[model samples]
Target: MRAISVIVVLAGVLSCRAATPDLRFGWNEVDYVWDSPTQRESAIKSRHFLPEHNLPLGLARWKNKLFVTVPRWKSGVVSSLNYVDIDGAKDQPLKPYPSLKDNYVEDTAKEIPSNSSIVSVFRVFVDACDRLWVMDSGLADILGSPNQITGPSIVIFDLNTDKLLHRYYLKVTDMKEDSFFANIIVDVDNATCDNAFAYIPDLGGYGVVVYSLKQDDSWRVSHHYFHFEPLAGSFNVSGIEFHWTDGVFGLALSEPRENGYRTMFFHAFASTKEFCVSTELLRNYTHIDKNEAFHDFKLLGDRGEGTQASASFYDISTNVLFYTQVNRDGIGCWNSNKPYTPENNPLLFSDAELYEFPNDLKVDDEGTLWLLTDKLPRFVYRSLDSNELNYMIYSIKTKDLIKGTPCEN
Candidate 1:
């Protein structure tokens, strides 16, 4: 009887482990549709479009389109903003979002505060209002040709019409010499969309830049928590090893509390600690010093070693925060209702091959958890063998992701 009971429990565990999500997309290197065969040939000939150099760092889904951002961190990138047809072939070339002319043809590097001026985009956010928020990093070749091609700005598009809505450039005061807006999230009440606010983290600058869509204004707030731990700067993803001092790179906003303000869960890219600050402070912009103080932010404790996260998303359905741990190469989750401890937050799954540097994590409108794993460390320090799969994307229902785990509730 004892043997049978043990076998039953083991079988249950196997079933749960086998519940991996289907691969939505896989690519050794991303390709795109050019205006013409001649243009494609010329771009490659000019060394303007190197397949291996173009890496997708952000992911967002809207209806039938999946928006991807391939930042111009290095040369050979043909398009900085693009999208793929979800219902088309499983493996297909990307189509520049909105139109090809807007992404590549125009000399976007100098077209500041314009729709056609997206030099490079990192991570994007699609709000409940069916609007896609594209945060242009402005600086390019950051790894190889670090240049401020354009000033950092926010380029928003109406997902409903695939048209430009607004373009707000960040003021000089909103940036530090090393500012790199790596990630962004939207705070909006769909019923009243104009009051939307965007929270963008300056991973390289070590601060958070807030923008008000209605006011057409922006501000940058600083805090000690935004700094990365020097010891945590070292990373080993798969077999590639690298060091990055990226601060405050991930952002997740919870459902509004009794005060009608949300709790923003954020962390540095090179640290294992997670912290939270109220949106009230960020949205107010009443005084920078008051909001930037330590008391304004609360430490959620350490997530243990080897859990430096990059991008995170909050699931309203489960009240769980899903994030990517680049060091561990997996996703971890914690129910907001529970304390932020090792016991409360556990690495849901890990795959060195499939998740060899999970860079983006998102919860779509349908309660699905979308994860993008780009072999970033290898792409930066070493080289990603294009012959082998170098980039992968997976989507599993949020409920399925936490099944049988402490976050299940």
Candidate 2:
């Protein structure tokens, strides 16, 4: 039997106890830039500029610019990838990364992938070599009615020059039906840049697809923990009750061990349990490890009741794991040096309103912890006030986040 200890906290008090800094940027609804005046006019004339329909899902930072992803889950998402200037005005409209031509378009001719055009993107990651790894879902209208436009692929770019490096489409054998490539992490050292590997989570298919840059091939891996926990699917955020069955939605890599392979900590969006596997095992796509794979994957432990998390990042500086506490409307941390349990893990800060439905969380190269909250339940089930802030981004240095707390070493 599992020991389940639940802590009941008053939402009002949690909201007051939040110490996170003010929102860096927020909007009633996000806006974007176009290639030209004609393109802007065309987008508006065709009813493809519905601001409220676009939803920001993923984020990554490279130096002075912060990259944000707006998935085509509904109509009116003109660009799938954009960036915000850290020194620019607050709530400024986002400019398309690279150019609007590289993003999505509504034309029938644009439905196919034409020389670097992206259908949609859900996640982006920047490696130590200053390369931005983009997970192009090749999908559109995912929230209302998901549609596959192009084959799922990874598009990488040289952040220094904003030039394309490589684009690899997944092997058909690697992508199962309903495979939603929602998140990705690039594992590569600066010395071995050409021999890189990417770990992508198939949230819809309940498996992870590994890609090799050197071999230019991909393979799929599965474990029972990739599936969602049905008992933990129920969610109540801001009085909006709903259920989610997303699987294997979060992945965080620790500093490399003595053997030079890192430990990957992952969790399902609909489950409270955290699990782990070695990078050495996942790197070998050629191996069929049905018998060996079972014992290779280990369960870390449950995070606690109603503590299902989304995006996670393992800070090498503090040897801590920071995650978005979705159900509790807060931010949480766990000192990886200790065991993964309720007493060892703590929800450091929470706010019923400010942190409502926190979606994406990331730790940038500067040791800053960034978070993006969309109040998604209100937007999906109820209605968002056009004049009220619905989507927001917040950031704070990791050192300050765990200075005196037990999260620090």
Q: Would you list the C-alpha lDDT of every candidate in the order shown?
A: 0.82, 0.82
Question: Residue 44 CA error for candidate 1 (Å)?
Answer: 1.0
Q: Tell me the deviation in Å of residue 94 in model 2.
A: 0.8
**Model 2 clash tally, residue pairs:** 0
- The alpha-carbon RMSD values of the candidates against the true structure, listed in the order shown, are 5.6, 5.9
lDDT of 1 by residue, 1-409 (tens): 2322333354356446655555677777889988899998988888878888888888999888887788886777878888887776545788898776676732325444445566788899999899999988776667775667677888899887888998888999998888777678999988989999999999888999999988999998888999998989998877667888989988999999999999999999899999999999888765656734559889998888888898899999999999887888788989888888888888887767566788897888899888888888778777777667666677789998798888888
lDDT of 2 by residue, 55-172 (tens): 7778888899889898887767888988999777557888887778787565233265465777788889999899999998887776666667777889998999998888898888
> Which 10 residues in a row give candidate 1 its minimum summed lDDT?
1-10
Residue 314 displacement in candidate 1 (angstroms): 0.6
Whole-structure CA lDDT of model 2: 0.82
Model 2 misplacement above 4 A? 1-19, 107-110
Q: Which stretches of candidate 1 lie over 4 Å from their true place?
A: 1-18, 105-114, 287-293
Would you estimate the TM-scores of all the predictions? 0.93, 0.93
